[model samples]
Target: MSDPIVPPILPREFGVYFALLEVSALVQHGVEGQLRRDGGLSFVQFQILAILGEDPSSPRSMTDLADRLVHSRSGLTYQVDRLEQAGLVARVPSEQDERGVNVTLTPTGAAVLARVLPGHADEVREVIVDALDGADRDELTRLLRQVARHLRSRPPRSARRAPTRSAEA
Candidate 1:
């Protein structure tokens, strides 16, 4: 048999970081696959639906939804347009701000979410939660939250910190 191709062992500091990113991507793909094959929804689509479900009465502006999803305005518009065409959601002129538009999940969308959520929850448990024992899952949760907290404090890409002065200076 041919020798297996493997990446050179990464540095200790970066190893877990890279592995976490890879695992995150793979798990997202797995969830996406289940959504597509079983529920006919894309991951982004499901996220949008979940957000709407979170506050059905509140008018979710297109810009707000885009910001919440970290998507470009145009990309979000495209997704919302598709959802509108599918009759899953509707865009209404914002009563509070006529210049803006609000997206609302239709009854059909709500019904669909109600039907799909239980199955989706089970799939999530199977693909992620069930794979970990209780202790590990709790530890992962705590660690991930800590990482998220730290990440939120980092400066944006365009911002840079000034250099510290040396003691001699």
Candidate 2:
């Protein structure tokens, strides 16, 4: 419930933005070392696995993954390539769309996910969860989910139309 020491000129929304960014950066930095030590995975790679692991029986298309991650398809492809090389994920032709590719966590990927999850949970708990009381955590989660819902309702930055020149500029 306490506010971060945000600059006066930045205003309330900016304070929330900076605070969220700061917290995420810290949590990510805290786990970066552990993730490397345990799974030899980068944060994005872990995010990809974590997403796929959410429903191993279901597969996510590369385009779906790209939009979900707010990443470029090529960037995601490179990471998928690396994961593919590591035997962590498999890219199969989409049954619904032949040109589309679906990404799934392999058994090895699932095993790796299971192996790293405990430490990941512990690290997340220590860095972020432990910072708030139960009620505060609940409120935070609710507020974040609300904000996420609002944000997700909008089209992705890339999909939005760019403003056109008025010619009078």
Largest TM-score belongs to which candidate? Answer: 2
In candidate 2, what are the lDDT values of residues 20-94, reduced to their tens digit? Answer: 999889988999878888999998899899999999999999878878887777798999999999999998889
Cα lDDT for residue 23, candidate 2: 86
What lDDT does the true structure give each of the candidates? 0.81, 0.90
Worst 10 residues of 1 by lDDT: 152-161
lDDT of 2 at 33: 78
Q: Estimate each model's TM-score.
A: 0.77, 0.85
Candidate 2 stretches greater than 4 Å from native: 1-10, 157-169
Question: Cα lDDT of model 1 overall?
Answer: 0.81
Query: Which residue pairs of candidate 2 clash?
Result: none
